[model samples]
Target: MHIVYPAVVSALLFSIGVYGVLARRNTILVLMSVELMLNAVNLNLVAFDVWLRDRLHAGQVLTLFVIVIAAAEVGLGLAIILALYRNRRTVDLDRLRLLAETPAPTGSTSVPGAVSPPSSGPGEGP
Candidate 1:
């Protein structure tokens, strides 16, 4: 088979991934879309590696490294998503934006104002 076949397929997969990333509001779905894009690139790399006459297998080696890095990315992404969901109780990006704009609760020591030091220099105090 010609190398163009795999290349075309990879391009389609990458397009789908781009659409998903843009259309999806859920963080997990976005991450999944990114993974799909990586898979497409990997497929193209492997296909080219097989078709090439070189003995070094550069494309295949690069695909292996890509797979390894993708795994690490997924692991880290999941951990971050889990932490965000636990803290906010929702994974929707819209809701997250609302949370960001809201002011901190009264008497909450975690707020920035609670941690700031009192002014010590002249003309610094209200």
Candidate 2:
């Protein structure tokens, strides 16, 4: 029943979640870590609610809100991960770095010695 018990456990869970989020290369694992962190928060909210003995039970109410949000986050996160996997064929975060890089092409857009037409200024009427 001591507040310290839940506080310490929540801290440990939160720490592990942080490590998972930071050190894991797989996107799915990262999402799980985020869920872990959210659970830690929920635990702390319930612990403090019980400890305070408030009539309104605001802490517990907020914990319920957090749980709802966490559920929505998981749903959205999985959808995004699935989409990325389909497009890239892998969910490895490192491999996703290339998503930002534009590969040099042999097409006419940037071919050697090709002159680009000048842009029309705002003052010039086409």
Candidate 3:
């Protein structure tokens, strides 16, 4: 059980996760890739913790904290993805633009060099 073995495995997992996050188009798949990366980090933490023989088990404790954060991230990420799917009917990251402006409503005219006069309010007449 040499340290190199676990380190190599962690590196491979992280590489794969990075590929998934970069190459995948689906939002859910991207989230899963991020989780994979986090798990790889946890593996590294435990491996180093055991290798160092720390009395405080700081590696394991930190791994636990990372797991907790990962869980929370998954929960919130899934909720957002679900909401986007419900509204947009697709989770393709390229097509999903939350801040993109929508087209104007139908029957609206915008002509060049066209100016309309302003109307007066109840208390402010022209």
Candidate 4:
């Protein structure tokens, strides 16, 4: 096979990955996109290694390293996503913005100079 075949495939994979990362809102999908990008890089690495017919096969070796790092990244990334889902229910990236303004509280109209009642929790003085 010609080198162009794998090279073109790798380029397509990378473009798809970039599109996914840019367009997707769900956290899991974003992570998957990042994985896709990494896989594309791995494909390029191995394809070039074969095309060059290198005795050291350094590209292939680096591809292995990338796979290992990607695995570790996925593990940690999923763990964080799971924790976030537990806390926030939805995994939408826009909704998860840390700096977003908080919505105002509802339905408690206070009169001017009126004091709010205290909570009646346990161990509290009345």
Candidate 5:
């Protein structure tokens, strides 16, 4: 009974996580959803370990590893999102796409045929 209950709960959690990841555009929300999925897997692992009479605590050990990796992933992902936001001044996915549409900033001595020259200028020879 306990095994079945935990398994079902874990599956539900996993499904919810998937939905959140796919439906949400915010990077932070996606990250939180990922964490939720990881936690669901951890719950399943621990539940199975408890149900089975294992010689070694393999499931628990694996759960620990999952938790550690999840923490690292969130840290790295947040850092990347922060950097992107700082560069673009917005976190929305739609707005971020503007970055791709726009060309790189122009400067003196641009590569030939790479970028167009300034429309009008007095001392603009590049």
Candidate 6:
């Protein structure tokens, strides 16, 4: 019944979630990690709410809000990941460079999906 028990478990869950997010190369795994972290937070909130015996149950209410947000995040995140997989055919975070933060090399020619200049037609004069 001690708050310490739930708190310790929450800490452990959060730690694992952080590790997964940092170490996993797959975007889906990272999303799952984020859900795990959010769940840890939810566990803490409910535990504290029960411990404090709040009349309004604010902690539980906030936990519900967090759950709603997490659901939306999962939906949108999966949608984006699926779209990327369809377009580029890979889910490895390191390999997926369409959204790379670094600028493209100046000398690089023909960026992905870039349309080349149209050739002069026979009718058009040089």
Which candidate number would show the highest TM-score if scored against the true structure? 2
Give the count of colliding residue pairs in each prediction: 0, 0, 0, 0, 0, 0
Better of 4 and 6 by lDDT: 6
Which regions of candidate 3 deviate over 4 angstroms? 102-126
Q: Give residue 119's error in model 6 in angstroms.
A: 20
C-alpha TM-score for every candidate: 0.76, 0.79, 0.78, 0.76, 0.74, 0.77
TM-score for candidate 3: 0.78
lDDT of 5 by residue, 22-121 (tens): 8888878888999999999999999998888667999999999999999899899998887665444456654444323345377544322323434442
Residue-wise lDDT of candidate 2 within 30-110, one digit each (tens)?
999999999999999999999998899999999999999999999999988875654455788876654232445754332
lDDT of 6 at 109: 35
- Which clashing pairs does model 2 show? none
Best prediction by lDDT: 6
Better of 1 and 3 by lDDT: 3
Q: What local distance difference test score does each model get?
A: 0.78, 0.79, 0.80, 0.79, 0.76, 0.82
**Which is superior by TM-score, 2 or 6?**
2
**Model 3 lowest lDDT segment of ten:** 112-121
Residue 71 in candidate 5 has what lDDT?
87
TM-score of 5: 0.74
Better of 4 and 5 by TM-score: 4
Given candidate 6, what's the lDDT at residue 31? Answer: 97
Q: Once superposed on the true structure, which residue ranges of model 1 sit more than 4 Å away at CA?
A: 98-126
Worst 10 residues of 2 by lDDT: 109-118
Candidate 5 regions exceeding 4 Å error are: 98-126
After aligning candidate 2 to the native by TM-score, how far in Å is the CA of 13 from where it should be?
Answer: 0.3
Pairs that clash in candidate 6 = none
Give candidate 4's error at residue 63 in angstroms: 1.0
